[model samples]
Target: MSNSARVESPLEHADFAGLAALKINGGVILREAKLLGHLNLRGNANDPDFLKGVKSALDLDLPLAPCSSAQNANTTIMWLSPDEWLVIVDGVTEAAIEGKLRQSLRGHFAVSDISGAQTMLEISGKDCLQLLQKSIGYDLHLDSFPINKVIGTALAKSSAHIRRTGEYNFQLIIRRSFADYIWLWLQQSSKEYGLSVTL
Candidate 1:
């Protein structure tokens, strides 16, 4: 099948088009960073050659520190473990990115395209922080969870790779099967503050 025929994000069946019509002036705005590429990378961060190759290939350094990210216009790399990282890019480019990484990276490294297994949800607004606080036990204060920081944390009964993008904005990397549950949870949790859905 062609790329266009094969591409579909996890929430494509969730009728986001209907939700897009809702006013975005609410206290909580939720939307999917749909169809984006997701790549899981495993390599030695301490190896200078590996780090240099990554930068050369992606134009972004691999963030060695735990729970940190390095990003630019086309890609975002999140640290998942000491030797593992998640690279996100425009959905259509995932295959190409993986191929390039495979060619450029050498010695005890692995890159897998996980775009179909996961999806990203972005939550932002005045109440985004409060809504998050209700879901997880992590301390989200700026003093602790600064912007560009990523965390593997609990959301309701599911798990997500939570990344702080801005003062009141967050990006969640959630499993495809749990997307619906999390969406429902967001709706229920944001009732008081008012939730708006966007594309």
Candidate 2:
């Protein structure tokens, strides 16, 4: 393997860095959480050992309830299903974390690195709620979708795992193949409120 080989983010061609310089008072802010590690974890939710192994490895408890998520300083665990979770961690740590999980866990478990298959985009600012309301059918009201809740839903023509990170902020986990399309859709949708980019 050559050291010169570089890993490019899925939205590399969108030139987010260039847009970051623009001084726009946009109601919606878009920031790509680029190059983060995405690990799909599966195990028996009923097994105490499985739960203990995960806690030992990540130092964070799994979110067992449907559409729930838990996060610490280094990792965010989202409950994807009864027996599966999506774990997001800092960039370049997927292999090490996976290794820890493999070492700690025993019997009937699976962990796969899916970092390259997708990307995360954070949408926030004043108009973020309105933007999301137009994009997905899910209710954005705090009563319905409170903070730290994750749901897999349709976003425009594509799909994403939408997570509420704050009162007016959301993180969208979108597929790499639809990065360009979603970027374009965001630009158009936020035209009235304005759109600003951050590196």
Candidate 3:
């Protein structure tokens, strides 16, 4: 079968439908950012050619600052290391984007599709910060983790690429194998605030 034909979200078996039916309005809102394209790219951050090629390919810059990201309407590039970045796009466009990058780049660079190995979770709402504080060691203060910032941090014994997308909202890129564990962790952490699931 084609990859797309066999594609399945890590949480496909989870009962999100039941969770969504809960009448209680939760202070913590969770949603799976499933089936998105994830590309692990390693290139020279100091190379103007590399940066320009990526910009030309994705219309977004490679964030040079530590723990920062650059996002456009359809893509986000998260800084993973001085020489590495994670590029996320709509699932259908991943192959095309990677192709463009490969064709446009020169010298030393590497791009690997990692969509099958990772998934994203959108976490937000009034009590989201408190829930995060309970789950992660990173400081969630606005002064420390402002919008558009990304951090590789520990979350309930698993590691996630956490990005602050808004004041109370975050996008977590987590390993597929650990999806259930993280889901359970979130459920437990947000119990006091109630749990709301969105598709």
Evaluated with lDDT, which candidate comes out highest?
2
TM-score of each: 0.95, 0.97, 0.95
The global Cα lDDT (0 to 1) of model 2 is 0.95
lDDT of 3 by residue, 93-132 (tens): 9999999999989999999999999999999999999999
lDDT of each: 0.91, 0.95, 0.93
lDDT of 1: 0.91
Q: What tens-digit string does per-residue lDDT give for candidate 1 at 1-199?
A: 5556566777787788887885557789998999899999999988999998899889888999989999999999999999999999997899999999988999999999989899999999999999999999999999899999999988897999999999999999999999888888988999989988887
Q: Alpha-carbon error at 102 in model 2, in Å?
A: 0.5
lDDT of 2 at 178: 95
By TM-score, highest first, what's the ranking? Answer: 2, 3, 1
Instruction: Flag the better candidate by lDDT, 2 or 3.
Output: 2
Query: How many Å off is the CA of 84 in candidate 1?
Result: 0.3
Please say which candidate is ahead in lDDT: 1 or 3: 3
Error of 2 at 12 (Å): 0.7
Highest-scoring model, TM-score: 2
Clashing pairs in 2: none
RMSD of each: 1.8, 1.3, 1.8
